[model samples]
Target: MRSRSAPPTVRDVAARAGVSPGTVSKALNGTGQLRAATRDRVAAAAEELGFRPNHLAKSLLEGRTYTVGILTSDSFGRFTTPVMVGIEDALGAGRMSTLLCDGRGDPLRERHYVQELLNRRVDGLVVTGRRPDPRPSLGRLPIPVVYVLVQSDDPEDLSLTYDDVQGAALATEHLVASGRKRFAHVSGPERHWSTQRRREGVGRALEAADLPLAPELVLLGQWSEAWGRTAAAQLLRRDSGVDAVVCGSDQIARGVADGLREAGADVPGRVAVVGFDNWDVMVEAARPPLTTVDPNLTALGQHAATRLMDAIDGKELPRGVHRQPCDLVVRQSSV
Candidate 1:
């Protein structure tokens, strides 16, 4: 019997299983056609001996590293954490390893990390960022690249991101269906793509109900609770008759709720409120739990990983920006 400390080699496994070294290789690596009985015997032998294949040699033979790289611009990891969990879960099942690099929104750092990942011979890469805007493409590279959350400017590149327009529309429709009319919108910086898309969504939905968003009712400001609170006072001053308010982010929604409550207005009674980004911290901690839109970022990450795997397997990458749908989470605030 071999010593327990030393691992069993393919030769030893072959000897025990009554097969040649080449046949053992074929069985373990899944390289050639073999009888069911023979494969079973080899597998059984391997299990008993705790024989693990040498991945280094196997990579050389197959010309594949079985490794993937994940590059993210979200240094704080607020958005990247959930996405990474999904990517790891999907890639781990395929016995692929992952390497992560943070660009922290720096061009020089991003370029450096990209070069380093390429030097490591990764089979594919997944690119992610917190921004919802479309960025300039990374340009053609040696391996397949999948973009998550942030879209690539190139329509041909496979970019998976949440559908901001649809999510906003969903929120507005819910409020409209609740019999609340005379709507007002509060959002982040005017230049943000998410802000534009969400505003368009609310406008379209309201227009469908024959209540188009007017110029004075649309409030564009920084994404902050203070701004939301200030906007609330502004809305009351501008249009006290407005019954429903849709905001671009949960933080802003929470602030609006506070402002309305502080102004002696009953929430959901005098003014119903809705928010985007179903962030638990902001939504749950609010005076009344917020009704918000969930971007479903984890699912987006999983899809990106699967696409990278497919591309590595010699399949052509599907062209275009794929918009993943967001889900609406209802709470006391909207009711």
Candidate 2:
């Protein structure tokens, strides 16, 4: 019998089962070809004793921690939240755990978290971000690293992200297919990588359709409902003939809808509105839901996690950026 304060051990289970410690060990591990009856007895004894195997010991013996660290700039950001869920899904399927650290977009804080994770000897690391820009690399580490939702400055590192350009193109094409010839684009800050890519995508689609996204028709501003309202109003004032407006985000789309309604323009009948980031809150809440682009961010996280696991398992890790495709969600706004 073990002490009341101490956890039951293999020896205790062996004693309770009337078997040798070595036999108990073999039976517990399903090794040594023990008789079925003896194995059953050992297992029953272990269960009665509430004996829990030490996973840390097993991991040490196997030369693996079976744990990975997730380092993110914005831990609770809308985009990163879904990505983290996808990562957890993949890691759970593999019976692995995660240590999450938020950097809050501060370089010093990020460096501190990285050091802490490394100190804990995480098997691998997943670096994620709030935006899809090239982030500073964590430099060389002893273990494999994977970047999610953003690529590292180092081209040799592995990264998984969505195709922003294609996403925008999909939105623009949807509007064009709806017989909307006159188009206007309103999006977030001009300096954002995603904004630039989305703008380029809309332009490319318009060019392919032999349509023009004239200078006055493009409005690059803050990513807010207020900006959306202001931009939509200005767009309408400048070109009341605009048949469709493509917004950079769902929030912006909501504002644009309000602007159009205020201007006595019928949504989808007189001015179709499309948005990016199929965010449920803004899309579903709008008077007449929104048609938006789904970036498949969760899938990107899953891919990144699986790729990191593969590297941990001694599989060859591919280098450079890997892009996942985005899909469109059709709703009343676009139709």
For residues 1-335, write the lDDT of model 2, one tens digit per residue. 54699999888898999999889878977779889999999999999999997878878888888889999887658888999999999998988899989998889998898889888988999999888999989888889999999889998898889998999999999998989999999999989998999999999999999998989999999888889889889998999899999899998999999888888889989999998998899999996899999998888888889999999989988989888899999999989
Error of 1 at 4 (Å): 4.2
Clashes of 1: 0
| Candidate 1, position 201, lDDT | 91
Clashes of each: 0, 0
RMSD of each: 2.4, 3.5
Residue 253, candidate 2: Cα error in Å is 1.0
Name model 1 segments beyond 4 Å from true. Answer: 1-4, 11-48
Q: Give residue 278's lDDT in candidate 1 (0 to 100).
A: 86
Model 2 regions more than 4 Å off:
1-51
lDDT accuracy of residue 291 in candidate 1: 95
Candidate 2 lowest-lDDT run of ten:
71-80
TM-score against native, each model: 0.91, 0.88
